[model samples]
Target: MARITKGILGGFSGKVGTIVGANWRGKDIIRSIPNPSNKPPSEKQMLQQMKFKLVVSFLRPLGSIQKKYFGLNSGSKSRINLAVSYTINEAVQIVADVPELIYNKILITKGDLTGFQDVAATPQAGNKIGLTWEDNTVQGNAAGTDRVTIVCYCRELGSFAVFEAAAERSALAAEVTLPTIYTGREMQVWAYLNTKEKNVACNSSYLGALTMI
Candidate 1:
């Protein structure tokens, strides 16, 4: 059987250009879903709608940073501390399509500066397993000065039932991990003539997994 792993990276923000204020607004990430109706919608349309939903529920909250820091003086350096929250709930529908049978253990890694809460796991099918994580808190020094990264890994078991059914089994097992880093940017929301700027951004991210074997 073959093993597969996928990584996604996004949320890039750069310094302001000639444009008025900062234009580093958040955007949503989406996966393709088949349309049930014959004339339902085009793939682009479906994806756009999904993106809109994600922006509304996850990205819009970040706009508060602008409102809170609207009065900063011109040419004064300021940060936009925004917290964008997101959730992942993906279903493969067919585990055989994955071509891999995972067993043993799974591990997740994140920065010590962040706190993760409310982790849950569930098995939905005979050959499938599901995991969910949420509620992450980011810590930064002097507000809007810290960043956090997240990574995950899973161990495979050669003795798993699915591996047993395969005609060929290797003595070695493979481990899966997300290679890209999930980043949180610092935003300076306020700045005074004598005092420094301060901002607080808090958000959560979730990953859903379905494993076979």
Candidate 2:
């Protein structure tokens, strides 16, 4: 059995063998490990396991925030799993189809700094991801809001596409093509307004997922 240990989260955080995170209450914790019944998992089973593990590892750093957000009802990692699955759901290529989500007020920066005024994304025709956003330089202390950083996390491939919005355009709509392997799978997109002077980033906005058709 793997032993749990404390991490930098001011609480116990450890990973052993197939399990990750610390023991809490009577449970071992989230990033639930998979149990393969056979000696060697089938190709399809392997894919599913890979995806699950990827999601868990990716969300590892957000453990503390998730715990706080879930409070007393997290329930054996069910909340986190459901939340992740919901966010991972969505499809590919076409013009920006999502309703615009505007950031009108200053959101309390979560990680380090704040971000753009608004951001939205949806798949465009031809397996392309379309991103749109409004500049917030005038609304807040955006004296350093020089660029926009967008990231697309491929849930199937466990990879990312990091693209920078053109600095010259304030209300910019940018496009990025999905890899051939991504067809029929979903991706989570994230956005941030970045400045040249910070170590951390503007609180990242989860822009939803888009699956390639």
Candidate 1, superposed: residue stretches over 4 Å from native: 1-41, 65-197, 200-213
lDDT agreement with native, every candidate:
0.26, 0.54
lDDT of 1 at 87: 17
Each prediction's TM-score against the native? 0.19, 0.46
Stretches of candidate 2 off by over 4 Å are: 1-56, 59-112, 164-171, 198-200
lDDT by residue (tens digit), candidate 2, 1-213 = 444355444334555566666656665465657776658778656555555554456555445434333223445555355434532332111224322112222121234344655678888767777777765556554644455666666655756666654442255666677777777778777766655554344555777777876
Clashing pairs in 2: 91-211, 92-211, 93-124, 94-123, 94-124, 94-125
For every model shown, the clashing-pair count is: 5, 6
Candidate topping TM-score:
2
Q: Which digits, one per residue and each the tens of the lDDT, describe model 1 over residues 1-213?
A: 211123224322332232222123333323334446767788657654564454334323334433342233233232221111111122111243221212111111111223233434333333332333332323222122222222222222111111111110111111222211211211111111101222322232233343433
Evaluate candidate 1 by giving its C-alpha RMSD to the native, one decimal. 22.3
Q: What TM-score does structure 1 among the candidates reach?
A: 0.19
What's model 1's lDDT at 26?
36
Q: What does each candidate score in C-alpha RMSD? A: 22.3, 11.5
